[model samples]
Target: MASIAIAQTQQAQATTSAPSAAAAAAPAMQLEPTSVIVLDSGGGSIKAGWAHDSQPTIMGNCITRPRSARRTFVGNELDQWGDLSGLYYGYPTQKGFIVNWELQNKIWDHVLSSSVLEVNNFAETSLVLTEPLFNFPAIQSAMREVAFEEHGFQSLLHTTAPELSAYQQRVDSPSAQEAQVVVDSGFSSTYVVPFVQGQMLPSCATRIDVGGKVLTNYLKDVLSYRQINLMEETHVVNEMKEKACYVATDLQHELEKAKQRPSSNTISVDYVLPDYTTIMKGFVRAPVARTGPANMSSDEQLVKLNNERFSVPELLFHPSDVGIKQTGIPELIGLVVESLEEAAQYYAYQNVVLTGGNARFSGFQARM
Candidate 1:
């Protein structure tokens, strides 16, 4: 929370400094991004911001929950921003895209009602709202209607966040004028978008619905299967993944090392189980007495078990092992390149820029 607060403060400071800096340096500056908006409607987050900035000003979703001031629907109401109630809160997107209309409207309403968006401040602003590629016409029409009729904005524009990231990269690298591949590993899915001279290659661009959520769920399942019993409790399992889990470069070799005897290789984790007793963590089908003498084989089994938990998440890269036919990041990148015109593949590679939450996965960029 402190880190978030600090970052927000820095962003506020930057926002204030930009206008003054621009005014002081006006003579040298020609055309600037000046007034632009960018929106990313990924599964887990809905981020809106000015284009020249690296971060978002407004980030929320269509999901609602019981908040402090309200019984339900905290996300829709603006009055409860600082005093959000302690109830269920969530975004409208389920897998990666918007499915619920009421929730979407509520989120949009809350955004418009924000103090930053007050009528006196930004009435004639240029707006940009992102949508999924090949978005349904009905959703598009509804979006347009809401922005024009409800918000009363003068200018409106639409584009994909991944495309904009690609544009930013292209602008930075002028030589990337050929076919390009963009891998947007966002919250909902990893999208492989191929482009030829800035035009989308609709047929070759594919979306795979495996991502962070899948990784978390997979970790939960592995821990549960090892008798850790995380089904009723996800907090510790989530913590273990966030704090300890890592993808191994070589699975078989790592497994062999993890199978070693527990003298120097294994360490115990103290967990207060449902019974509220501090017990050393190990791989056991049933909980053993913490007060009892330590056993050697049990410790070895525990180490192997933890290794399996760590390795299982690697299945996302090669889903064929689990019978899912979706392509992984590197394969998808090649596919995107292939889908473009023959001359454009190299250009696309040079301009390929990755964005979205999933891009932060360890080794994701290297693998791509």
Candidate 2:
């Protein structure tokens, strides 16, 4: 989780230079914690809440139109729509960068005006918004204009999410060394960022093109080829991936185990497909003894999963499996650590941190 901190400036600049001794000694501007709002926007979701709150309110970062209804829903509004199957999704971000401001603006308006954040007057609230690392200067300028001119915020602080994560670590462990490496795997891509003395080394940062979005799409394609066609059911497929998929600690061992007969294979299981009426979301069916098809219900649809559960997540470890031509995350982290100064390498390796939605995969830490 990212940490919230108050800045002395109204419009905080992204800089690497340290403050002068006199400036550092001066008292900083104070603001009530309740008056500040922290918004951590990412390609997959947007996390927002008051600065004093322990947890941020998370919501999807897209606008959707359900197949059953003609009305469109923004952000968290999709929860109200019972039928999530075959929903049409419009995302404001692509490859971890915001590209469609028109769609993004609508989602932002809904989040700020609705009960999620409930900002009655932007002028009275200070905004602490997070942006992607290595963001374009034009996008940064546009964000400032939107915050000050469009939203009329009294003050604004722009920072990256990884920086906040590193800051939080420092706060949690004050005795720990300052050198650390943050592995951020999100919707569109994964980044290995190294921070030294609370500052990031942008030139040494590495990026991998695979993330949760790619994994979900890969699972969709594989399932479509093997069983039912789920080309338009991206939402349903994503839910299924989250509930069933897991990282493999030993790829070869797991593969050999998965090749066994379904009756004896521990990795093999059936995923119950949602019918929208009885089940809103798909679930992993409990293991059952069956000799033939007669034991299964005719009305229920089950997708038999075996090697796919581990093979899909394997792409993160070896993109070459899909011909992406990039090194896996573990090797990339090693390369990043070696590229740093000799003195910082040891501490960086010792303080490595895994974050983002994709990091929640089972056995992810063990695999790393």
Candidate 3:
């Protein structure tokens, strides 16, 4: 868990003379929570909305150019495209860090100026932006320039995602302990962070290279080798991973079940691939008894999944399987706790928090 700190910076105007009596009598302006925009910028998606909203609006963080279309789509515009095959994607961030400001500036322009966020005036709105832990100084500087100079925001408060998570935990459970450990498994990597009494310990934090993007790419490779050649279909394969994959509590037992015949294998299932005509997105075709002749009228494509479902997600627990030489999330969390003080270790272990997109896996909590 990381500590949350809100520090707003505003530009000061240079005045040569004293203020007028009428100006001095007027009250100073203040930013309300409803007028502030909260943006959680991630490698895979951007979670943005007003501070007063109950939920954040999620938008894809990458720009895509479809093979069928000549023009490119930015952020949420990809949803309007019907054909999703062979989309060449351009990302503003790489490995969880902002490197391409040119592309990111475009995304920000679209997000702030377009109807997505409905920001009427950038100069009047204060922004609460989140960046990754140990972010580059150059990137941070660029972000400040973008917010104040490029977008002309009235004020900006920079923070990290884990910090916000810790703050939310305190708000939700005020009677809970003071120490917390946050495991943020996102697109580029996973981070294990510790916070004690609302203060983050940067030295004790650890990171793993495995994340949702690696798992999705691994699944694509396995599917391509076993089924049709889907090397270019990243968009489709990502959806497949979300719809079909899950963590396994008993890895060896599940592997054994997958080894059985298809008729008797309980772990095996058929994932119907999208044809972009009848089915816009793929679905898991329910297992049916083959007691009669097969229906010849339907021409749907399918990929048979057995061990790949659980094996892909297993990389989070064992990055060694993919030759990453780093410890998994569980070991990483333990290492962070061991590095902390004895008094904080107990509370950190007791109040562990799991966040990010990967935490939504079907059996993730059970596996943990």
Which candidate comes out best when scored by TM-score? 2
lDDT of 1 by residue, 1-368 (tens): 00000011112222322221212323322323444344455665566555466555545464544333444543335334443222344566666666786777776665555543333334545456677877778878887887788766655555565555555445446654465566776556677777666556667888777765566667767667866556644333443454455556566766776666554334223232322122322123321223333533332323124474445456556766556688767677776677666676667666666666555445445444
Tens digits of per-residue lDDT for model 3, 23-101? 3212212456566787778898887777666566678888999998999999988888898889998999989999888
Error of 2 at 58 (Å): 1.4
lDDT of 2 at 203: 94
Candidate 2 achieves a global lDDT of 0.77
TM-score of 1: 0.70
Rank by lDDT (best first): 2, 3, 1
The best candidate by lDDT is: 2
| Candidate-wise lDDT, in order | 0.53, 0.77, 0.76
Candidate 1 segments exceeding 4 Å error: 1-35, 52-54, 57-90, 115-122, 227-229, 232-247, 261-305, 308-313, 321-323
lDDT for model 3, on a 0 to 1 scale?
A: 0.76
Shift in Å, residue 163, candidate 3: 0.7
Candidate 1, position 183, lDDT = 70
Q: What is the lDDT of residue 33 in candidate 1?
A: 43
lDDT of 2 at 219: 95
**Model 2 Cα lDDT, one tens digit per residue, 1-368:** 12212221111121111111012312213556677777778898888777777667788899999999999999999989898888898999998888999998888888789558889988888777778889999888988888999999887777776766666655555522457777888888888888777678899998999998999999999999989999999998888888888999999999999888767788887888898988777888644543456656777788888888999988999999888999999899889989988988877877777777778788777777
Which regions of candidate 2 are displaced past 4 Å?
A: 1-29, 287-296
